[model samples]
Target chain A: MSALLYLVTHKLKNRVREIFHRPSELVLLLIGAALVVFVVFTGNLDVDPGAVRPRAELSAIIFALYALVFVLTAKNGFVNGASMFSMADVNLLFTGPNKEKTLLSYGLFSQMGRSLMLGLFILYQYSWVHRAYGVTLTDLVILLVGYGMTAFLGQMLAMLLYSFTSGSDSRVRLAKGVFYGVIGAFVLYFAFLVLRAPEGELLPKVLAAAASPVLHFFPVAGFVRLGTVGAMELHASHIAIGLGCFAGCLILYYILISVLDMDFYEDVLKATEVSFSAITARKEGKAQEQAPRNVKVGKTGLGKGFGASVIAQKHRVENRRGKVLLLDLTSVVMAVVTVAFAFFTKQPVGALVMSMYLMIMTIGTGRWAKELLLPYVYLIPEPPFRKLLYMLREQLPALLMQSAVTFIPLYFLLHCDPLTVAAFILARTSAGWLFIGVDLLLHRWFGAGSNKALLLMFYFLFCSLSCVPGAAFAVVLFQILFIPLSVSVLAMAALNLLLALLLLFLSRNVLSASESNNQ
Target chain B: MLQVNHVTKKYGKLTANRDVSFQIGDGEIAVLLGPNGAGKSTIIKCIAGLLRFEGEILLDGFVNKTLDAKKRLGYVPEMPAIYDMLTVGEHLEFMLRAYKMEDDGTADRLLERFELLDKKNKLGKELSKGMQQKLSLCCALVHRPSVIIFDEPMVGLDPHAIKQLKEVFLELRQSGASVLISTHMIDSVEAYWDKAYIMKDGAFVAERSASDTTEASLEDLFFALTEGGADA
Candidate 1:
């Protein structure tokens, strides 16, 4: 236990020292802290003060989110178990002279820290939450505590379930059956409530169902939700019952582990290995996460191209496997969600903006980025500029397809002219190119010395800076030239495309200059 | 043929390879023997045109980064980096196509030689580490490169595959291709290397040839150079 404490303290001390050692990372951290402070104090992300949402509505949303996270976490744990331990922990602590109970406590302690960190994401929404719910500091802290507890409880339950059912097929089956049955019952109960209501508006009935005391009796999510809602509404009994239930669950888990003397090393090993590999793959910018377990080697060859063009062919083949059309599952989902959002809010352009933002956020995870990390892209016998163009070939088509799928429906929804539709599609697809350009430019500048936090800060900064020229052009065309909005949009799109091309040409040397430490 | 003229590479202030000059002529097999952090991989990467360096590297009398040179050069990285989505067979085909080589069953033959023919249809992710290394080797070889480089190639290879790789090196040299192998596993390359360079502190401390090392084995020479002080 003392060793574990020493390890934790040293790890924390070193992590702080590491941040300070990397000046750029330290600067980024400071900037992040400044931004958080500004946002929290401002009580708004933007000029418009957030509209106060109903407390029941907020409660319902949080409850739904908590429930979804719990279910997914449990399902994953059922198969692979929950891993609070990393590969290093497995290698060092698991093999060291430490009691199992102490090690378990250390794992849970680390897990609690992670849960707290995860809960901090909600702090970024401080402005909106405070404005919308009239939340005080104490209320916010209570909610944060509730959220962290919910996360911790979910993992604890997952660990217990895994330990109980591991290595026994019948036990797993029975556990899963019980799990599904409980979930089914809750859904049925909610549906029954909604159906039996006096049927004026659907939302009130749903919120009423969410606020029902019956939900507070179910499990961890409910208990946490009750505590949070109770805190928000200042209900003492609700808080006690809700928080007491969570504490009871934790005590139960501790007793089970201590009494059963469960050997969970094997169970967590698989999850830890999976997590380590996945993290490594992400760090190396490998898009291997999308790969299905069972790949059908339908075709055995690239089937086309020589030299640099084979890269495009390789990407095409990989994309084909992941998608039926040019649009993959994610694209389809984005399109559907965008259309639904537009239909509900009657804000086609707003939905288009949201979808484009989604695309921009995800551009770094594409195959082109992965290509740069691997050796073949540099080893291929071609001019750097030409190789880059070929590398981007597959991305362009997919971006176009995604934009078309996302925005074409908006033509009808917006009741807009064809030119307007074209302009929106062009702008959206062009943003992908611009973001890709920014990614390449950053890589070209930083090369192998790129730090994630530093690069992320620069990535956003560069992206925003890169958009200025096109935006200025659009503004001039629209405000000065008296051009229609669609025409201005088209002009902006053209400028963005040209800028992306220029960036591509400038960043071509990234292919030649970039080095992988893996070598 | 490959020529590395006074090449130097640095990562920030740390010099990974300092004024490293070496050459491997056609039909020759040269091994770079170095301890960890001895700059073997750095020099290999510089020669492969994957890193920016101060000096010149020429393959077949062309700049290493040029199309002509790249076409003739093959590099197997120290860690096998195979595409998770691409099948083992597809990997070779992609390499062949990338190198503008005719698909003349070289892929299959190489797979057979590496004992990867049965798992040719397996996705790269499905193969074990040793198998992935085998696939990486097959990709590098399918192009029939005139100059081939391997960095720690035997790290994950099975005994049979290692033996097969040594044979392949001889075959490649017989075919008049230059082979440069970077490995700390001195015994693996002792039997066939025409020349060996022992590197320390980012520079070659000693060079030995097969004909010159009659009095002392490569193992003894390496220990004398690398571990002599620690031993004393």
Candidate 2:
């Protein structure tokens, strides 16, 4: 146990030392800290009382978010199991002189630490949450605790479920049946409540259904949400019931593990290996989202291409195997979820912003980024500029398709002019391409094997800076010159395209070999 | 022919390869013998044009980073870089198309020779390490490069695959293609290497040829040069 403690402390100390040693990373951290401070201070701004949304709506949304996360996490555990241990831990700590129970406690402790780190991102939304729901600082703290509890308890439930169901077909089937049955019951109950309300009052009815007392005692997610909202509302009974539920779950897990004396190393080994490979893939700029279990190896060859065009052909074949041709999982999820969000919230602009945010986060991990790591990109007999264009050939159509699916529906929902909607689509597609261009320039400047977290910070900073010129131009056109919104947006889209082209031209040498063997 | 002239590769202050110059002629097989971190792989990468080095490398009179040189040179890295999504056949096809070579039936023949014809449909990720190495070898060979560089090629291969690879090297030599192999396994290339360069501290300490070193075994020569008993 003491050795484990030393390992954790040493790792943390080294990480801190590394950050301080790197001036760029240290500056980025300071900038991040300043942004957090600004956001928190801005939360004190006064807003119209009548414009503030009801607390029930916010609680309902948080409840649904928790429920969705916990459910998906448990399902992942049922299929692939959850792992808090990395490959290094499995290799070093598991084979070392350590007790199994002590290791398990360490894993749980590490998971809690990760949950706490992830909760800090919620602080960025403090200003908006305050304006919407008039939440106090203490209430925000309670919300953070609720988020921590949900994430921590979700993993605990996954571990418990995995330990119980692994290596038993019947047990897995039984678990699946119970899981689906519970989800089905909740859906039917929610639908019943929503249908019983008047047709025009759908959002209110859905919120009412979520705020029902029956759901307050439901499980890890519901309990955490209940305790959070109860603390904010000063409801004594709700807090008691919610906290009691969590206590019960903790006691049950403790008793089971103690009584059973379970050996879970083998069960966790596979999950840990998968997680390690996924992390490695991310570091290498590969897309690991769609790890298909059963790929339909349809037609075998890279269809038809000469030198650099073979890269695009190869990507098409890979996308077919991954079943992500024109619209990938990210695009589909973004389109469906954002459209539904717009339907409920009646905020098409919000949906557009959300979709763009999701696109920026995911577009960096495309297959073209992985191509830079492979030798074929450099080894192919072609000009560097030609290779760069061919490498990104598949991305343009994919971006166009993604924009079409997401923004076409948003057109009618926003009730805006057709030309403006078209300009929005064009702007969105160009922005996605701009992100790819930024990624290429980063690889060219910093090499592919640089620290991903630091590179990601640079990525975001560069992307935000890249948008400034076009945004400023659009503001000048629309505000000062009194030009139409559609024309201003189209001008922004044109500038974004020009910038992307310039970036691509400058980063042509990214295909050239480097000292860092990214493979 | 592959020529590496005064090639020096450094990572910051640590020089991995120091003024390394070597050449492998047509119809010849040259082997680099070194201990770990002796700059064997660094020079191999330099010849393959996969690193920035203070050097001049030419593949048949073309600069190493030029398209003409890339079209003529093939490299098998220490780690087999097999695409997880592409099938075995697609891997060869990819190499063929990327090199702008016509379909010459060489891919199928090589797969058959390596006993991988039946698993041609298997994805690269599904193969074992040995199989992946074989597929990587097949990809590197499908284009029939004039100058081929292999870095630790026999590490993960099974005995049969290793035997097949040794035969392939002889065939390549017969075809008048320049071949350079880097390995720490002394006995692996003992039978076929026309010339051997023993490297230590990023510099070649000794060079031996098959005809010149008939009295002493190659292993003895390697040990003598690397284990601090002999001078350059």
Candidate 3:
């Protein structure tokens, strides 16, 4: 058997065995099965164009797919790469005496598998799709099919683009020029249509224009938009164009292989090296930053050599060499974009929601959390509690800075009460501490070397369980005791902090020498 | 002095090291010689306090994994654990802070001796394998611990670094610091080992002093014992 086929078969067999054998996973599967049955039989999935505007929904879909495409393009760019193969594939399949096109097929197959996994996620959002977009079951199914197809098509395009452009700088620039030209032409075309339409009907006209076949679908940015919109609306002309474009994507995806003469082994090795490093870091609950390298040498100094001062100084040096500071350019851009979103949506909580997204994202970036993965942190000859405090000092301040950037804007824009601003900031910071505390507790109990999937499951469970107590307590306290909102939020923050401290204390010896490598 | 008493390490059902006991006194060099999967690294990790085992380890008089023992112990792990974000110089600084000791020029001396002074500003990730191994040695040597452990210390080093490390082992032994080294390389084991233990199947199968039976060379004796009735 081929390496790719063998791994895929082996993994599928394992997954099936796990589903069939394990009681917990089996129960979850059964519940999901029951939910699907319930939805098919008695679920209220009816839709009415009478209430919601289908055009606006179409507009949302177009913008949403565009955003996804934009991110996909950015990730597949030379500077920021993407991975579609496992390390095993990189090692075994790439090194095998196979053609580049064969490897490409393997990569494409893996991408389709990923899309299938994500399709399950889309199925879970069916009710929201029904309620928000007035999409019926049939519309929802078509939409999901469009989504999976588009994702597969996007990967195909990315591979072709990467294969064509990545070998040199001039080629990359040329590729970018062509790409931006297409987007620019579409933009101007879009502006022309919208401007020519009557004042109240611009969006409807733009939506109609987006579905038209003048936009070629193989280039994907415009064609994918056309195909997806066509699928959602069940337009015969649109579906025909969509299927034709999809077929074109498949053919071009293969043709590009022979045309570009892609060095699949080299490309995969590079991709897999990066992917494996990230996977390793994430598995160890570490930050995902490019490994620091090629920095200008400076004088070695650990001034004062105080108890925790060295850690703080290390951060400063790291910031100087790499992006040690949390509030770097990316944070600035994220803040601007998030604030713009809130302003455009005219939703005060949108700011908070965006901030929460930023919070979750920033947690995964460079942080003290990642420091634990390296053995030095554990091997450090210091009091575990003191070391813990030192790490917290570095981590908590960054969390605070992020929260300040997030909620401080809301304080002014929403004209929130002083108490509301204070509660929001404290509650968010408390949530950060709660995450660290639970992470430490889990690391101590489960061991840092635990399987990545199991660790993630525990992390999700903790995120769920941790949110319940504070929110539940606040809600029940408000309904029964009639506490003021500020007091309730403050009390919840205090409760979270108390729990965090208790957890930290309980897991204080997490980095102690006695702790073994069970990973 | 470093002591590992009846150490037994298991990974679920597989025993990596079992009933392994050994000791090295002050100013003594001990070598644990084994082939791949011969339980050398497992025993070394158990001694370095990186793995849990069903036994006891002591550095000087303190429990090996205790903070007190950690302060006195320096370990050069089999695989150099490079901190990507830290430069060569900063790694030494980090050791100083962690051990709560002033540099007193020890770091500079080690860096200078290892010929890494020119590359002190290079981050851990920028260094080649040889450089990484040299930096690992520098990190382990900076604090001037009373006990030091090296696991396959010569594996990735260039000839220059291998020579420096061999010199370091002798110097460490001369300074009244006990040194425990684990390696399959006969040459690395030949010059430094005062006491040699051949390990296989998770336990020490044979032990001999440097003064014991010079007629049979270490390599010849190793192969004979390892491939003999014990199937070591």
Candidate 2 wrong stretches, greater than 4 Å: A1-35, A41-51, A92-99, A130-142, A164-171, A217-219, A232-237, A251-261, A280-289, A336-347, A514-517, B10-14, B198-230
Q: In model 3 chain B, which range of ten residues has the least summed lDDT?
A: B223-232
Question: By the DockQ metric, which is better: model 2 or model 3?
Answer: 2
Model 3 CA lDDT for position B140:
85
State in Å the error of residue B226, model 1.
3.0
Residue A39 CA error for candidate 2 (Å)? Answer: 4.0
The residue-level lDDT of candidate 3 at B60 comes to 95
DockQ of each candidate, alpha-carbon based: 0.69, 0.57, 0.44
Q: Which scores better on TM-score, 1 or 3?
A: 1
**Candidate 1, lDDT over the whole model:** 0.81
- Which residue pairs in model 2 clash with each other? none
Q: In candidate 2 chain A, where is summed lDDT lowest over 10 consecutive residues?
A: A282-291
Q: What is the interface RMSD of each candidate, in Å?
A: 1.7, 2.3, 3.3
In TM-score terms, which candidate is top? 2
DockQ of 2: 0.57
**Residue B46: error of model 1 in Å?**
1.2
lDDT of 2 by residue, A224-325 (tens): 898889989999987887788878877786566545537788877877888898888656444454547677888888879888888888888888887777
What are the chain A TM-scores of the candidates, in order?
A: 0.80, 0.88, 0.75
Clashing pairs in 1: none
